[model samples]
Every structure is written in structure tokens, then in C-alpha cells.
Target chain A: MKISARNQIKGTIKSVTKGQTTSHIQLEVNGTIITASITNEAVDDLNLKPGQNAYAVIKASDVMIAVD
Target chain B: MKISARNQIKGTIKSVTKGQTTSHIQLEVNGTIITASITNEAVDDLNLKPGQNAYAVIKASDVMIAVD
Candidate 1:
């Protein structure tokens, strides 16, 4: 995926705070906090949270996931 | 804040599609698509999406907003 965000940092998942509806995803990218509020379902689906080394991929276009 | 990602670009808001729980925020950063899934209330509170020129700020650390 091609992203065009001016600030892209590589970070690790420090924590994943779960809320009723949304979850706070904390990425420790370069000693900075890059948080993304996403749905609980997505969290479960992605199996995300702390200790999972992944890319905080941000795209310039509207986010759409194609399961193919 | 200091981020440690290798990539970063500038972009504009292209569109915002509202979902039941999460909203798809489309950002046109340097002709690329950077979509962020945020809460509907955040979308309303920020009054974000389309035509609004803002920064797609991504930090390496877990994202935390300090309300001062």
C-alpha cells in the first residue's frame, strides 16, 4: 500500500486500551505516541495489541480493506 | 513530538464516509490516500474530512492527546 503522510514513524505497540466501543491503539514509534482509535471488532479481527510488531500503515486515501 | 518512521508526506482531506460506529477519513497526502478510521464523535468534534487541509500526524509512541 502506498501512503503519503508527511509523518510516518516506525513504532511498536506499547498498549491497547480497550473501551466499550472503540479501542486506543498506542504505537511507540521513535519514542513518540501515535494513537489510533479503532473499533473493538477490528481489534479482535486484527488480533492486535501490545507486543505485536506491526506497521502503523496510514494511507492517503479513505481506508478500505479488501479481503481477497 | 518526535517520530521515527522513515516515510512522511503532506496531504488534504478528500472525503469522509460515516459508518455506524467508525468513520473512514480519507486524506489526500501528496496524491496518495491515507485513510484513518476514527470515531463518529471525533469526526463531528474535529469537524474533519474533505477540503480541510490538516496534518496527518503519526508518531512512533502510543498516541496520547494532552488536553490543556
Candidate 2:
């Protein structure tokens, strides 16, 4: 979905696992692991899994980038 | 905190608002909204807001990317 905000990155979906009630989706973007939780139905529709490439679409008002 | 995962995006913290119990931090990366919920304490420590660049560190098992 085209959410209102700014900060979209192309990410590779690494894996999709089942959470308690929400499904946990892991994305690999620039060698970083980006995790998001969605509904079970969403998981079924996406048909996600490991090795599958996807995007970690983030929609928040606060984005924090930490450096080493 | 350095999380064990891959998919870290360098985003700018657009805004930091108060949620029920957790603090909602909005992040802007490439014109997308990447939101994350942190504890109130974390929010206080970070002292985040708009224009502040941060990283939307996602650590999930499933990442989905949709196209038009």
C-alpha cells in the first residue's frame, strides 16, 4: 500500500514465521534484519518464506538511525 | 542495542508521539513511513523527533514487498 510518509527502501524478504497472533516477517535490507508483524491472513495471502525477496515497507512518524 | 538480524535502513525520525503505554516513533526513509513502538523510557532516552535521522531496525521473520 502507498502509505503517506517518506522513507521507502528496497529490501529482500528473508523469512516469514508465525508469531503468537501476528506473523513475523523478516526482511534483509543492506545486510540488516528488518522485522514486521502482520496478521495470519496476510501471511497466507503473501505466501512468504525464506529466500524470498521482499520490501520492508515502514510507515512510522519517527525513524531512528543509530551508528557505530 | 545491536540486534541480530539484517535489514536496517537509515531513516530520519520524522516524529515521536505518545501511545497508550508504548511510545510511537515515526521514521522517514526514502519517502516512506517506518514506524516503531518503543518503551516510554527508550523514547525519553532517545529524545527523538522530526528531522532527526535514525534507523528503522526491523527484525522479523517475514518481509513482504508489493508492487503496482
Candidate 3:
């Protein structure tokens, strides 16, 4: 499917932490680990698992950074 | 400073919504809007405002995607 996000990093699933409403998903991209929070229903729909290839689609607005 | 995250998208601040503890920041990247939830403290620390150049740094572990 087509997504509007600018950064789509290709990675493999490392882990999946399912919560009551939200699910924490971990992806490994080039030795770096990325984590995302999603809904449990979405997890069931996607059937995400370890070793599977997925893309981390990041929108410029969804990322928060701090500078000193 | 170098961060552990993999995805760093450059964009301009579109808006900032402050709440009790968390703040939502919207950024425009390449014509696409990206929204992020951050702490109010981080907002003040960074001095975020509209029209400022900021980056959306996403860790691979933080991005969750679903495919149908």
C-alpha cells in the first residue's frame, strides 16, 4: 500500500510486546533497534512476527527530538 | 548530538499542542505532515515553535506498520 511518510526504513522484526490496547513492536534495521507503539488489533491483522521483513514508515511530524 | 535512532527526517514545525504532560508536535516534511507526541518538558527545553526547522528522528523499534 502507498503511505505518505517520508522515511521508510526496511528492517526485520525483533520482538512484539502486546498490551491490552497498545502493542510495542521492535524492529532491527542495520544493527539499530527501533520501537513503535500500535494497537493490538493492528498487530493481529498484520500477523507480525520475528525474522519477518517490514518497513518502519516515519512521518516527519511523529518524531520528537531534543537538543541542548 | 548523535542519537540511537535510525530514521531522521528534516521538516518545519507546523504546530504545537501542549497538554498536561505530553505535547503533540506537527511537522511538514516534503509536503507531508508528521505528528509526534512528546513531553511538555522537552518542548520547553527545545523551545519548539512554529516555522522552526526540526527533525523527526525515529528509531526502528519505534515505528509500527500494518499491511492488509
- For this target, which candidate reaches the highest DockQ against the unseen true structure? 2
- Between prediction 2 and prediction 3, the one with superior lDDT is 3
Residue-wise C-alpha lDDT for candidate 2, range A21-64, written one tens digit per residue:
78777667666567777787777787777777665554433333
Considering the two chains of model 3, state its CAPRI-style docking category: acceptable
**Rank order (by TM-score, best first):** 3, 2, 1
Question: Which regions in candidate 1 have their CA more than 4 angstroms from the true location?
Answer: A1-9, A61-68, B1-68
Candidate 3 Cα errors over 4 Å, as ranges: A1-62, A66-68
Write the residue-wise lDDT of candidate 3 on A1-68 in tens digits: 78876557677889988989988888776675668887888888889988888877776456776533
| C-alpha lDDT of residue A27 in model 2 | 67
Instruction: Write down the lDDT that model 2 would get.
Output: 0.63
lDDT, residue A4, model 1: 54
Ranking by lDDT: 3, 2, 1
Tell me how many residue pairs clash in candidate 1: 26
Q: How far is candidate 3 from the true structure (C-alpha RMSD, Å)?
A: 7.2
TM-score of chain B of each: 0.69, 0.76, 0.90
lDDT computed for candidate 3: 0.76
How much is the lDDT of residue A26 in candidate 3? 80
TM-score of 3: 0.55
Chain B TM-score, model 3, reads 0.90
